[model samples]
Target chain A: MGDYVFNQRHLLGLADYSAADIRHVLEQTRTFREILERPVPKVPTLRDKTIVNLFYENSTRTRISFELAQRRMGADVVNFSAATSSTKKGESLKDTIRNIGSMKIDMVVVRHESPGAAHFLTKCVPAAIINAGDGAHEHPTQALLDMYSLLVHFGRIEGLRVSIIGDITHSRVVRSNIIGLTKLGAKVTVCGPKTMMPPFVEELGVRVTYDLDEALRDCDAAMALRIQMERQDGALFPSLREYHERFGIRMRHLEQYPDFVILHPGPINRGVELQSEVADHPRALILDQVTNGLAVRMAVLYLLSGGSRV
Target chain B: MPSRLLHADDFDRTIRRFAQQFTEPYDDLSPLAIIGMQTRGVYIAKRIRDRIREFRGVEVPLGVLDITFYRDDFRSLDKVPTAKITEIPFDLDGLDIILVDDVLYTGRTVRAAMEALMSFGRPHRLRFCCMVDRGHRELPISADFVGITVPTYTTERVQVRLAELDGEDGVVVTEGA
Candidate 1:
C-alpha cells in the first residue's frame, strides 16, 4: 500500500502542499539519501534536462545544495546572479527571465528579495519554477530538509513537539517550517524576542512565546533559526550579546532539556543564535541538515521535472 | 487470450536443474555471487540461491539491483521511476557475478543492469540467467543460463509469477498492448 503519488510541479512553498504530498517527498528523499553513501553517487536521471539557478539575493547553503543536487543528477546547470548581471543595467525581472527562457531551460531555481517573485515567474516562462527563498514569505526547501532531519532523528514527525527559536519576523524559514510541520501533525512553538516575533504567527497554527525555557520545556526537537543580522538593520534587539543571553540555546539548555534534540538552518552566528559548544554537541543535527538538504533538494528537482508525467 | 506455460511443479524442477547446472563447471563457488534485478528477479534469485545452497553446500552473496536510474527510455515511461537501494554488502572486485532476472526480452534491462553493476567495481566475469527467454531481441544480448525458450509475437506478454510476490509460481502468456 505504498502507492503514494506526488504530482506537484513547482515548489513555491509548503502552503501549497498537502500532508500526503509532504510525506511522499520525504519518502523519496530517503531513497535519494541512500545514493549519497554509494561510491558513484551520481545518477543520470536528469541527463536530458537543463536547469538555471537564478539568484536575485545572496545565499551560500541553499544555492550550493541545489547546484550540487542538479549536477549529481547529470543535469546541465547555468548559474546567474542578479548582482553581476543585466539587472545592474536597469533590466526588469520580467525582461531578464524572458531572455533567459529564450535559451530553453527546463527549470529555474530562484531566490528573490521580493515576495511572490517565484510565483510571478510561473506566469512568465514555461519552465518549472522552484523558490529557493522568496523574501519573508517562504523558503520551502529549507523546511523540507529540516523535516527530513527530524524524520531521520525522531523517526516520525507526527505528534512530535517542535520549538522554532529566533527571528520569526524576518525568517522565510520559520514561515515555511510552521506550515510544513503543522500539516504533518507536529506541535510547533516559536520562541523569539517581542520585536523579532511576527504579528499573528499563531494564526498559522503555531504557539508563540517569548520565553525560551517554556518553548524548549516539553518539545521533542528545537530548530534555532539564524538571526538575520543582514535583513534587520533597524535594531530589532538590544544587542547580539543580550539576545544570546535571553534566547540563545547554550550548553546549559542542552543539559537541561536532555530529551529534545537541536537543529539549525545554518551559517550560525556562533555566539548569537546558538552557543558554539551547543552547535557541536552530539545532539545537534546541524551537519546532518546540510547533507539532507542536498538529498531533499535533489528530490524536489526530480519530482518537479515531471518525471511522473511519464 | 491468456495461456499457462508452466505450473508450480515445473518451477520447482527448473530451479533445481539450474542449481545443478551451476556446479557442473566450478568446484568452488566462492568466486561467484548472485545479483537479482528488481521486482520479480529478486524472488527468482532467492529461489535459485536456496537451491544452490542445498545442492553444493556453498552459500554465495546475494545482492539486489534497481536499474531505474540507468534506464535509457526514462522519458518514454508512463511515470517517474522510484529507485530502490542497491545493497551489495560484499566487494565486487575479482568476482564472477551471476545476474538473474525473470525474463529476457528486449535485452535492454540486461544492458541497464550491466551498466548499474559497473559503479560498484570491476567484476572478473558476469553471466546472465533468466527464467524465460521470450522471443524479441532488440539488443545483441542473450542469456547464458535459460530455463526455457518460448517464441511469441512482439505484442504478447510473458508473465512470470513467483510465489513470493504473486501468491503462486507459474509462467503465463497473455495478450498485451
Candidate 2:
C-alpha cells in the first residue's frame, strides 16, 4: 500500500498522472473525509511539516481551502500573497522563491496568473510544489475535488458520463477536469458558444456541441463552468443574458434527469450558466464540493509531503 | 528476523492475564475505554477490548489514534513520514482509558500518544499497556499493564506481527536490524 502512493514532488498538471495515481489520491481522500467528520477533526500527521501558500494570483476559495487543509493536518502554514510581497518591489519570481526556500520550507502551495509558474519553482527550490491554479493551463486540485464529489455520488468514476458547460476556452478547471476524469474512465462532453469553446476541443477526447439541451441530457454528472468574465478575451459571447438563455442550466433540465449530480467551482454566477433555483437544488454539490475540497487538498498535501517517492 | 518471543498460545494467556490484573482496581468497566495507537497498536487494542468483554462481561468503547504528527523526531527521520489517521469515536472527557501498543521502546510513541490524547479531552486517568516492554528508555514513561518484557541490544530490532495485518501472530528479534 505504501507503493500505492503519489510518488511526486510537485503536482503541476494531470497530464503526467495515471488512473492509478488519481485513484491513490481518491483513496487517501476517503480517509481525510472520515477524519473531517470526527469530533476532533484535526490530526497530527503533518505536525512538524512547514508549508507556504505562495499565490501570485488573487483567490479566496482556493487559498483559504488549502490553508485549512494544511492546518487541519497539523502543519504550520504561511500564506504568501505576491501582491503584498517583495515581488511588487521588483524581485524576480526565482529570487522570491529562493528566499522563501532559504527559510527551509518543506512545501509550497502556489497559484499564479501565468502558466508554468509552479513548474519553474520546482527547480528553483528544494520544497515540494503544489499548483493551486496556473492561469488557463490547469487546476489539478479542483479537478481532484470535483472527482471526489463525483465519487461520493456515483460510487465510482469509471463508465460515467459528465458534461461541462460554459466558457471552456478560458477555464483552467475544465482543462484539468478533462485530463483527470478521462484518465479515470469518465466521458467528458463540453458545450458553449463557438467563440467561448476552444478550437478543436474535441481532439482532447470529449464530445463538443453548442447545444445546452443536448449537453444537459443523459449524463451522470454535470459541471457548470463559471463564466470567466474577468479573464475573457475579445467578447466571446454577445451578452451575459444571451449566454444564459442558450447554455444556462435551469430547474427543468435537472428535473428531466433526476440523478444528474450537479457541480460548480464557485464564485458562482447564480443566473449565468446555472439558474439560481438549480444552484439550490439538492442535486447541486456546489457546497459539498467546497467541503470535499478540504478533504481532497488534505489528501494531496499529505501524499505530496510524506509519501514522496524520493 | 529469526528469534521468536511468543506464539499464539502464550500470546492468548498473556493477554488474559494482563486483563485480569489491569481490571483488578476497577469495579465496573462501564466508565473504561480502550484506545489503540495507529497501525499495530490498534490491532492489539481491539484484542484487549475483546478479552475484557469475555472476562468482565462489558463492551468497552474503542478508539484508534495515529501520532505521526506529534512525534518529537519528525525532523530526524531520514525520509518524510506518512501521518496516520486519528479516530476517536467517543468523547474522552472524564473516562478511564488504557492506551495499547505492541512493543514499547524509547517511550517516545507513548509520550506523543499522551499529547495527542490530551487534545481531545482530559480523561479521569491515563494508563498504558504494552505486549512487550523492551527496555530502551529515552523518557520516564512506562507501561501500566505489561504482557511480557524482553531486554535486547541497541543494534537489534523487536518486531511484533499480528495475523490481522502481518499474516501471522508472533514476536521476533532481528539481529543487527
Candidate 3:
C-alpha cells in the first residue's frame, strides 16, 4: 500500500491531516512554488477537470483565491453564489448540492456560514469536497496557508511556540490553526476572554489562557483572531473598548517579545482584536500570509486532484 | 538475446575516444556552448563539459532545455510528468550549441528537444552528442559526437543509470518479450 491513502473525500478540518500527510503536502508545495513563477503561470495538470465553488458566505479573498487556483491548474471553475441559488428559493442545502453534483463536478469547494455545512454537503455529493470555510467550525485552507507561511519563515515546522489570541471560541481560523500547528510539532496556546474562549479547547491539545500578556510573552509567533461583530451582540464581551483594552494585541503587548511574528486571518477590524500598528509591524506576516494563500491553495488543489500520483 | 556488456573502463575509453575526435584543433569553434535536455541529459553534458574543461582552460557555457511538454508520447505516461527545472544561465544566441544526452534511440526526444530549444533562441550551429548511440533512428537524425555505438535487435532495451541520480554508474541491456 502507498504510505498514505487519500480515500477521505472531503477536507473539513485540519485534524484530517496527519503529520506525514501535512509534510507531503508541504513538500509538494515546494515543487509548486516553481510553477507559480512560469510566464504562462499555469500547469495542465488537472486538464478537463471541473471544480465548483459553493460560497454561501460573503468573501473577497478566500473565494477568489480558490477560484484562481482551480483555473490556473487547468480545471474548469464554476462559481455558485448562494445568494442567487436555489437555496434562497426554499431548496435545501443537500438538494442544491445534489443537483449540482448531478452535473458532473470533479470537486466542490464550499464556504457556508453554518458550522459543519461542508461536512453535510460531503455526505450529499459524491464529488471531492474542499471546505473553504464553514461558520466557526473550521477554515482549513487558512490554516494550511498559515502553516506554509510559518514553514517559509522559520524553515522548519517543529520546535516552535505559537500563540493564537482573540475570540478563540468563535474564530474558525483558531480551531484549524491549533490543529495544524500542533500536528506539525509546534506548541500552540489559545488566549482570549473567558466568555470568548471555548470550554475544553485544551482537550484538543492546545494550552488555553485568558491573559493575552501571559500568552504573548516569549512566543515565536502570535496570530490574532478577528472578533466577530455579528456574534458580539449575544454577550460575548461587555464592550468593544473593554475587549481591546484586555485582549487586543497592541504595540506594547508586542514588545513583550521582540522576536515574535504577528499574523491575522484578515478582513481585520483595525482596532478590535489587533491594533493597526501591530498588524502593520515590520515582522508582521499578515500580507505574506495573503500572498502565500494562493500558493498554498494551489498546492492543496493540485495534490487533492492527484497531481502527486506521478 | 545475449548482448556484449561494456564494462566501466570500456565506457570510459569510449568517452575518451569521442573527446579526442571532437577536440581536434580544426574543430575549435568560437562561442562553443553545450545545452542538455534536462533530467538525464543534464548530467551527461556536465560530464562532457568537465572533460573539455580539463583539456582546455576555457569552460564552455552550459544550458538546460526541458522538452517535457513537447514530448510526442506524453499521453502514454500514466500521470502528469513532474516538471524538471530548466536552468540556462547563459545566452544561446549565435553560439555553436552541442546538445547532449545519455542515450540516443528513436530520435523523437531529440527532435522534440530541438523544437523546444528553438523557442528559446536561434543557434548559429547545432550538433548532437550521446554517451550511447543505440541503433534505432525513427527520425532523420544522427549524433555528431558518440561515446559508443551499440548494435541491438528491435526487442532489446539499453538502460543507463548515472551515479548522480541512481547512486551508481552502470549500463544494462535486457531482452524485451
lDDT of 1 by residue, A1-310 (tens): 2876667878999999999989888988987887787777888888999899999999988899999999989999999998899999999999989999999888999999999999999989988899999999999999999999999998999999999999999999999999999999999999999998878787999998999999999999999988887799698988899999999999998888889899999899999989999999999999999999999999888888754321
Clashing pairs in 3: none
Better of 1 and 3 by DockQ: 1
Q: Candidate 1: deviation at residue B169, Å?
A: 0.9
- iRMS, candidate 1, in Å: value is 2.4
Interface RMSD, prediction 2: 3.9
Q: TM-score of model 1, chain A?
A: 0.97
TM-score, B chain alone, candidates in order: 0.95, 0.94, 0.86
**Number of the top-ranking candidate, with DockQ as the measure:** 1
Q: By TM-score, who's the top model here?
A: 1
Model 3 alpha-carbon drift over 4 Å, by segment: A1-9, A231-233, A307-310, B1-6, B10-39, B52-157, B165-167
Give TM-score values for chain A, per-prediction: 0.97, 0.96, 0.93
Residue lDDT tens for model 2, A70-178 = 9998899898998898888999889988988888888999999899898999999878889999999999999999999999988989988999998898899999999
Number of the top lDDT candidate = 1
Estimate TM-scores for all models: 0.95, 0.91, 0.81
Q: Which of the two, 1 or 2, has more lDDT? A: 1
Decreasing TM-score order of the candidates: 1, 2, 3
